[model samples]
Target: MPPAEKTAWDLARAATHANLPLLGTPMSQVVDRLLSARIRQNAFKVRPATRAGVMVSGGGYQGKTETVCEIAAVFEDSWRELHGSHPETVPGSRDLWAPVAYVQTPVTAKPKSTCKAILDFYGAPTKGMDLPELIRQVAASLNDHGTKVLVLDDITRLRMHRADDQDTLDLIRAFMSMHVTLVLVGVDIPGSGLLREGRGRGGKSVNGWEPTQTERRFDLVELDRFRYDTDEQITAWTTHLAGIENALRLLDARPGMLTEGRMPEYLFARTNGVVGLLERLIEDGSTEAIVTGTERLTEPLLDSLPLTLADSVGRDVAAGEVPALPAASRQPGTRPGRRRNTSFDDRGSAASTA
Candidate 1:
């Protein structure tokens, strides 16, 4: 092989060893847009009070975390390139300038704890401070360092009606009050009362009126699984397959035979168009081939991989389900395109055979 091909092959082999985030379209573009908007806002001499934040709500395994993390990585890289490798800090202050500050909401979702988490992210002292004091400290620190955006993940876990939930809401309000643009990412929490449409009729707030003031400040972005019933869905699947095929070629491995073949119909059907599930199927299938020294993907290999068919039975389905159609009753050796009545249940997986 040529030296370039040899290098590509080596990199591809290494890629298979790790489960890395795949750069897909809408996901990458949205992250870039959010970051760019934040950067543009940062350039403003006076921060706009009406600057809207973004809320990305999706079901689990939709790459919410991965997408946000990717944004964080990109921001850090861009910041490092603009500033030197060593970030310039505030005069006589220990705070390091950060382009982005990412924190996961605590399980309790208490305002104090969540505030403390923000302070902790900024390396600020969080001991023995009242809620108001802590909030002030955190907001001040973020402003001091000029952090572009604050990303909070798992916002769905905030329990409504609980004092902690109110606290979480307060913490968020404090961030907004400080002119910090928030990038909230979490499972979809519809009718959570904490949010209200800008033009909503009547007074509809999730839990109470406390969140009413902050409710209209969000730009909502909801992500759903891809579909196979339409041309658009097929294009998404095919485009993703092209990316995977390119990856396989880099490994000098045989291209994805399953993707190249009719198996994508089966794949789209099984995974229900969830990017995460598709990624898992590809990752597991690729890793298996590499382990077994196959160096190529096949239908049987792709089919044999135990995939996460559905969720863990909150809405309806069981955890162990393989999520595929019962074998077609068509005569053997007769290939017929089949679309079953089975729909993608966003609730959870069902216990069914592959």
Candidate 2:
């Protein structure tokens, strides 16, 4: 039904579907396992050694930041549970206990700017403070607030060519020296010059330049796109689609609307197996389905919806051509045939020839 025809209740349900919570995937599971283990181990250690950190790196729309943030939030929830929800405050001090501090690396990030971002998270003042003072304040705040995990998102913005950016990177490395677990989220971190050692005076190479201490202490993990080349990969991809299908609320949407027949292949072609792009496609398709009275996701309906510029350019580069979806296999009951050729028939033919 069109918007004009939709009852108020129908419109309300559509809105709910549009804002569904983040669906779990295999990639998220891996990240959750690794990050959660690191945070848990760091929590128990009483030693003064610098705690290790995690760096989540991936291409655009891979949900690196969301996944890490969600994990950090989970850790905070448990940490607060173990400790009391409210701690006692001194007569002159504020009663603030933040187990997790999340901040974005400024676009024009410097050492002072980075420190200010962390202090800002704690609502601490940084006015008229120099670099050293700001750094000291940041450490003090972390200690006072009992912060166990600090997430620095969009860390790739700090390119290493400039002196300020190099100092910003060093400042982040110093954060690792504290007891807190530092989580850095960025795009293409390996190529972002973050892992490399800084240059000496006049941009000259330092003697025996090697991987920075930050790189050594931080374990880099990638949130990769879904793959469909093998049986296991295909199963994982289809399982992910099923989770999305289960979450959708369209009246006419059937169980296998997204996972059945060529729909899976078509969605993969459209989204290149990126979860963010897949969610966008589904969200838009669901809205159109609700509006046009179709109430179901069909290939034609999805194709008619305009492609996001990123998805369009990425699909073009990856597939090289528009993939053709079989018209007959679009129905919910239909199943796509095996992608691999049958070896039994080939063997029979070879035996006959012999």
Give the number of the best model, judged by lDDT: 2
**Candidate 1 similarity to native, TM-score:** 0.74
Runs in model 2 deviating more than 4 A are 1-6, 86-92, 198-211, 309-354
lDDT of 2 at 81: 89
Clashing pairs in 1: 192-206, 193-205, 193-206, 194-206, 310-349, 311-348, 311-349, 318-349
Per-residue lDDT tens digits for candidate 1, residues 207-272, read: 344445555677666655555666665777777776766665323355555465566666665466
Evaluated against the true structure, the overall lDDT of model 1 is 0.64
Checking candidate 2 for backbone clashes, the offending pairs are 1-293
Q: What C-alpha lDDT values do all the predictions have? A: 0.64, 0.78
Specify the highest-TM-score model's number: 2
